[model samples]
Target: MSYGILSKLKLAWTELDNDQKEQLGPYLTFTDYREIWAMGIFLLGATALLPLLIVTIIHYQLIQTSVNSEFILRTERLTSNTRRVVTFFLDERLDALRFTVNEIPYNDLTASDRLSEILSNLKLGFGGLTDLSVIDHKGTQLAYAGPFKLKGKDYSRQPWFIANQKKDSYVSPIFKGYRNVPHIIIAVKSVRSDGTWFILRATLEIKKLMQTLSSYKTGRYADLFLIDRSGVLQTPSEFYGDIYQKLPLETPKYSSRTQAVMTTDAQERHIIMGYAFISAKTTDTPFVLIVVKQKDGMMGVWRRMQANIKWFVGFCILTVIIVITIACTNIVNRLYHADKAKAETMALMEQSCQLAAIGQLSAGVAHEINNPLALISQTAGYIKDLFVIKEQYRNDEELIENIDSIMEAVDRCGRITSQLLGFSRKFDIKTQNVNLKETIFDVLVFHQKEAQYRNLNLSVDVPEDIPDIETDQGKLQQILMNLVNNAFQAIDDGCSLDIHATREGSDFVNIVISDNGCGMPEENLDKIFEPFFTTKARGEGTGLGLPITYGLVKKLNGSISVKSKENEGTTFIVTLPVRIQKEKDGNENSIGG
Candidate 1:
């Protein structure tokens, strides 16, 4: 019987389709499932955070470079624009002086009125012009404007006079004026009507050029300033305080002459210098229009790039987090349910083995008790018949009392005989569609005599509307009979047993047998599924009852599980399929033998 239960348990376990099988597969143990979930969660979390971290770093670097680049470029442009405006102003002033030098006929001028009129017009045409002078071929100041009262001071020894002798126009390097004005001299050569060369020298103020460059600001990190060819500050500098302050003429010691942007500091403050020469506009003169912009001033561009990068990083992080969370949650949920099903299946398997062993033992006891019981009943009837014929014996109180004891013995024997026949018979089960509630009631009727014999209370708890299930009648009867008997044996006096039936899932009906009996310990529960395992005393049980019941349940394509608490009670739950196939898949093991 124990072997039968084990076999049936193995069969029922095997009969499960893919979904049920997966829920109880050996590999899907709780610990293994937990580990899988843990790994999934870890990977998911990493997926979310890693990309964000990477993007944030890259964004920072790119913004830093881009902002720095933009600042330097704009600063260089500002410097160039400043130089051009200054050059144009100087060129125009020189041209005006040249016109005066060429038109003021030294031969026709009887007085200084002609030169004065022309000088005033030239001064009015240019905003920052300080002085305009006309020098002859001999370097003599032919005419002068403003406070310079000289009419013929230079006689031809000045360097600018010498250069003007051969050039159409020229710009002198920045120089300080005798009158303490910061200026550059613009010279132009003119051919007088006498066929002799003359020079026009004009002094242009540097402040006006500085104001042109300072007018525009590039973001917060960009401030533009100019450096002259000699590396002197040509435009008003925030660091040096004035346009006249000279910077170190040589490039920084660490700087390489690559046209790339660089970081530097003016007066201890960091700046991004975009230095480029005005070679395109300046005609091969050792004059560079250097543009320098501060690094910190370009923060607006940097900040914008940084902001974009931050948003990108944030988006990536959010996306990863969502994806990982969903994946991990799904995996964990599946594993959790799978492990739960496996646990229930394992428990059912154990209980089934325990019942089968008890059934086998009980069947043997029932057989042994049957013949003696029949003889006792026949002998008691004969004694009663003799007593009836002998009126005197019937009237005797002692004899009547002995006869009553015999009759009582006969009645007990008959009941034991009936129990033996029922327990020993290997029923031929007839399968049909039967309501699970009706089946529970029928099983209770079969157990009524046994319940009366043991003085045990039995109760049935089944819902009225339980769906009909296809199962063998005899087999289900045998299963229930074995279970009730075992429940009676497990408990002492004053214990009650409850049998319940109900619809479970869509395709299964559930029956639960519960008893407030002496339950086994946890350790014994583990071994209860093994063949011949029993907690019953010697001569009381064979431990085959549950096993046989287990076998019958399996044959009907059902499952069973037992939950027991020591000193409390035990519950045996059975889940039977509604309609079992006649020919199950070959992979399913046989419940029989």
Candidate 2:
């Protein structure tokens, strides 16, 4: 059903250039008219919004790029600043150790009193120092102060001791050493004139270093921590892992300057990371300083901005579509009305021209046809004269009646043709004594030959009690003639026509003419008497017969109505006044075109 409607609409939308379907926008029905409105809105909406969407997307991408770049740069800058602070913390402690080792005599540095004094001063000055120790050339701890009992401890096989043999100084990563507490060592070597060396080692607790890192500002879900080259956390983390535990993340490759990248954690949360491998100038130890932020948290502002932009764009699109729809509807409505007005004007012009041609044609045809009618009327009159002069034929009542009927028919024909010539002329109402049965019989006389030719059954049911009506005999005759003529045309061979005359009341009478013909559908019954409306094929009818009949009935102050069903039959009922009911100034009445 939908496709069928669409196909018809499509056909209505397109037509040949030579076709006369111009300016008739597919508004055959109200539904088609609304559908056209929808089509216009859809097309115009696409036209208006396509470019808007393209531009919004392009700008969204650009703004996203700018926001992401800003986040990364801010992360790198924070990491770089924090790394400097950490580097300075380690350098200050290491420098204090270096100064103490170079200035003190080896024997004095190894003395318990001297080392004990040094540990006290170091603790008072730097505050994170846990101990001071002296290791001899053989990797034995010769002296120690301020921490656990290690006065004679051996450290020859330790990694830190082994590393000291290769480098001038070292800053060890946080570890649980002999004391079994988290600490970092800053070691310095002192050489004697004999080229044998001993080391001055200072141990710093991890608490102060962890405190330093915690002071930096970060995001809501952010973490700042240090990791070694092997991906081991040196400082405690808020999220990743505790100190000395392996990080559940891929270790970043080393870079001297601070850099940042995005990755996911073991728990599958996205993270933004900034890292710098800080190589303290005074120590060989390097640690990666990383600042990690939740990817969702880091882009909070940008995401909010994106959402706002989307909502704004959506509102704009809706507003534009609404505006376009209203505009298109207004434009289409105006066009439709203008075209309707133009079409009506064109139809009126065409109808006026047709009426003019009909007026001229009727004049010419009436003159030609009236000549034969005049000859027949004259010949019938001369025959009546012969019948009157001869007693043998005059006394024959049937012969007299036949001759009179012939003259009456011929005179009726003459008046009809004359009326066609002046189509707008008012008919004269010649009121006289009208016998209803005799008038109906006289009208049916014209159809007898046709009824006999088609073998049609004709019937009339009129009681003799019907009173004579005082009406225009000529119009009464014509009215009955047209009704009976239509009935004859409607009925097929061997079909039937039924005519009945009955008094409607004391003042009105009804004449009913019915035929068993190919009846009119119910939809067309109302419009059957309208001018230029007919169901007959082209050239078979002029479509003016019933219109004239209806007007003539109205002019006589009567009413006409029809009832029919498809393939059944049609019945026309005419109600006429029983007594003479003249119009105001009846002699001056006219039927307007």
Top-TM-score candidate index? 2
Cα-lDDT of candidate 1: 0.64
lDDT tens per residue, model 1, 21-114: 5545554465454466668868778866877687777867786767667766666566556656645655566557666656766643324566
What digit string (tens of lDDT, one per residue) describes model 2 on residues 1-593?
Answer: 76753443343223323223442323232325457777888888998898999999999999988877787888888888899998998888888988898887888899988999999998999999999999987899999997588888899998999998877788888878976898888798777799999989999988998889888856567789999899999998999889889988889997777898877888889877889887777565758898997778877788899899999999999999867766776666765566656665666445435554564566677778899999999999999999989988978889889999999888777776765654544457767889888888888888899888989999998888778888888888877887777777777799999989889879888989898887889889867766558777754555667766776776677889998876788899999888767653253333433
> What are the Cα lDDT values of the candidates?
0.64, 0.79
C-alpha RMSD by candidate, in order: 12.0, 11.2
User: How many collisions between residues are there in candidate 2?
Assistant: 0
